[model samples]
Target: MPSTNRRCPTVAAPPQPTDPTSRKLLGRLSLPERRFVADALRAETVGGVLLLVAAVAALIWANTPPLAESYQAVRDFHIGPAALGLDLSIQHWAADGLLAIFFFVAGIELKRELVAGDLRDPKAAALPVIAALCGMVAPAGVYALVNVFGSGSMDGWAVPTATDIAFALAVLAVIGTSLPSALRAFLLTLAVVDDLFAIVVIAVFFTSRIDFLAFGGAVAGLVLFWFLLRRGVRGWYVYVPLALVIWGLMYNSGVHATIAGVAMGLMLRCTRGEGEERSPGERIEHLVRPVSAGLAVPLFALFAAGVSLSDESIGQVFTRPETLGVVLGLVVGKTVGIFGGTWLAARFTKAELNDDLAWPDVFAVASLAGIGFTVSLLIGELAFADDPVLTDEVKAAVLIGSLIAAVGACVLLKLRDRKYRALTEAEERDEDLDGIPDIYEEHTPEYHLRMARIHEEKAAEHRRRAEAAAGSRIEGDRPA
Candidate 1:
């Protein structure tokens, strides 16, 4: 079907910009965003460990004799610029101020996932995405059913609809399970999506009133921040003051100030053009994530998790509707939601689970999803701010629910871990004394294809060397 007399049309290539300043700015922006993600992941793992210790210490301090008074006093202490309506208690600062930093880091990660990570591909992200949605819906449904039918308030529905990624991953690391990498990826994507939903719920459902002028001012500040980024302004002095103004404006606007962090993060530029070496989002994440994971999150945990058990007995705590509902919603509802959702997706849709994972592996991971500590605690604080009794009850429930889920995951994942270890050992064994593993050789096509590719690479290298030698000889002959 080739045309004999066809003249190829002349197509012009897009012109490249030649401006030195523009090129320099562009060239300065190229660190791999993947590295930033890896760094953030590590930071979260460490943060999880620190959060655990801080929570335990807070509990001890809140319950022990004289220390309990000191703990209460510290949390109740208030000192800030009262003129600006910022004279908030320590607990308020932790929830509103420090948590914003944590949310900002989360926002950056969400942007990365949406733009270039697994979420960039809908088909590939289907299982986790579907699972996350179902996970949230199912938990909220359970909470609503429990609270609505009982004497509990319906306002706390969103409390159990969160997944603590750091705590869950910390459990995994401690357990030392041999899960497939895909499972970790699925868990992470699901957690990020879960956080995104929680943020939406906080912004929309939780807000009571809005000050339009203040909200508009916050929006304007964000727009100006975006403008500075687009114009290649990288100074912290320029962005920090603007970010604080936005946060304060948002706070005054009656929207949760933490939402400001998510908004600003979403507005950040993530794409890299021809001349840029690194995207603004990646750079900002690198600069800010350490602060979030190391200080902000742990400090929030310290202030938020200090629930005293002196007033109410453990039995009495569990009897409360809010407590029972949160425990059931997290432990039972989360397991059912995530596992059932993923199973249904695989059954109904063309999307399939990773072949490397088994049904039990997914179920174990689903149990891990129930470890809703951080955001669950945050929501509990918000939900029961007026009722100290309910707040204590809810906090106790979150801790208990997280513990049960962690234990279940450890047991299930440990069983799978042994199986994987056995398989790996079998794969490493070469009883026949061949160069390759016996298992690899048993899979003849795969083994042959791998070897053939290696052979082809060697052959190509030889050909290139031969061509270079021939050219070198011809050049020498001509010169002589």
Candidate 2:
């Protein structure tokens, strides 16, 4: 009556000690931060799809009967302060204004990687870093070779050097592949460095003249901005006007105004302070990224990617040296440059691909790197500004080249995805259904002999306890 046959209560197991170094090696973000990144990535994927749709819609509008004139009118419409020589067309505003937001997001990502992510360790980051550099250089070289004396100015050599990370990642996500996370990490690091190189190229080579007065004003503003950030000034009221002043000055100074975005992003403090729960930089990025991805990029793409192919003959469009060069440089140059760079580094250094990846995986990623859209279009505009026909050709070529790269990457990555799924299935095989895989407990060889022995001892002790409990139950029943 008093529950004489009641079973003994079971004690809960203590939590296992986690290895901090292992977390570092895995490069795992904290739960909240990881979720933030995931949300940002998902937003970017959606943005990429929207960007594609905008570009396509623009092209359709440019070629269609009634919408063509309106589209052209909108693209040509200019309304800014003419006193400061800033009254640029709608297209120019999208490029010089909205695209600066995109560059700001890029700057934050680059800084984050440099400070806390994969690029923190030079040795750990060497492969992708070197590959990105080589990737940029090779494309420039290829484009130059094809267009040296053919037709267009060689200033557009940098046109095909960029890789649009958002578009590439969006394509990968659409493929629904189950590849290792390392592949995504490598792509991101490579793209960040690639963007850095592209920015440097734009600043150094593209600037025909520099106004020292304006430049000095920009520098002063930056200094003030830095000083305020150091003083923990968090209000947008103080920073917004200052930032606008800097961007305007930088634009007048013949340096790209987008550089201001990068400078401000880099200056934002990322580490938490004593009284703060979150870093100001992270909060700012979180606030600004949706604006950048959802609005700025699509707007820029809508303006920049509209190439009216209504009049050009097939032979003329395809046979132009600039078009040929840009297409080949994006498709062939990027693939060879990134893949070859990675291969050469692996051969020379002790660095190897992750166990979950192979050379084929790297090759596929290299192909994905060729999806150079937004920045490629911007560079095309810059490179062939004097040649309108060539500019349109370059835009069309970017679309074609990116499509080729996307298709190739999807096929290769999908195959790799299947392989990973098989491995995951094997990894999850648990014979006893105890939530612990027998494979993990039994697969340790001599290197993990101590752990194996401990596991065996624990198993035997569990068996002994179980046997004793059975005997105790039998004795209690007999006594009753």
Regions of model 2 farther than 4 Å from truth: 1-40, 149-152, 274-277, 310-314, 420-480
Model 1 residue runs over 4 Å out of place are 1-38, 275-277, 420-480
* Residues 269-328 of candidate 1: C-alpha lDDT, one tens digit per residue: 777768877778878887787788778888888888887665454675567777878888
Location of the lowest summed lDDT over 10 successive residues in candidate 1 = 22-31
Per-residue C-alpha lDDT of model 2 across residues 1-480, encoded as one tens digit per residue: 012132532221111222344322223233343344555567677778778788888889887888888988999999999999799999999999888888988888778777766677786677778899889988888888888867555767888899998888778667776443445567777888999998998898878899999999999999999999888777889998988898999999999888999988888777667998667777888889888878999899888877766546335546777777888888889999999988877777745444444678788889999999999998888877888877877888888878888898888778667555643454445544556544444534642565567789889999999999999999989944
Which residue pairs show backbone clashes in model 1? 26-275, 26-276, 27-275, 29-277, 29-278, 30-277, 30-278
Tell me each candidate's TM-score: 0.80, 0.81
The residue pairs that clash in candidate 2, if any, are none
For candidate 2, the per-residue lDDT at 289 reads 86
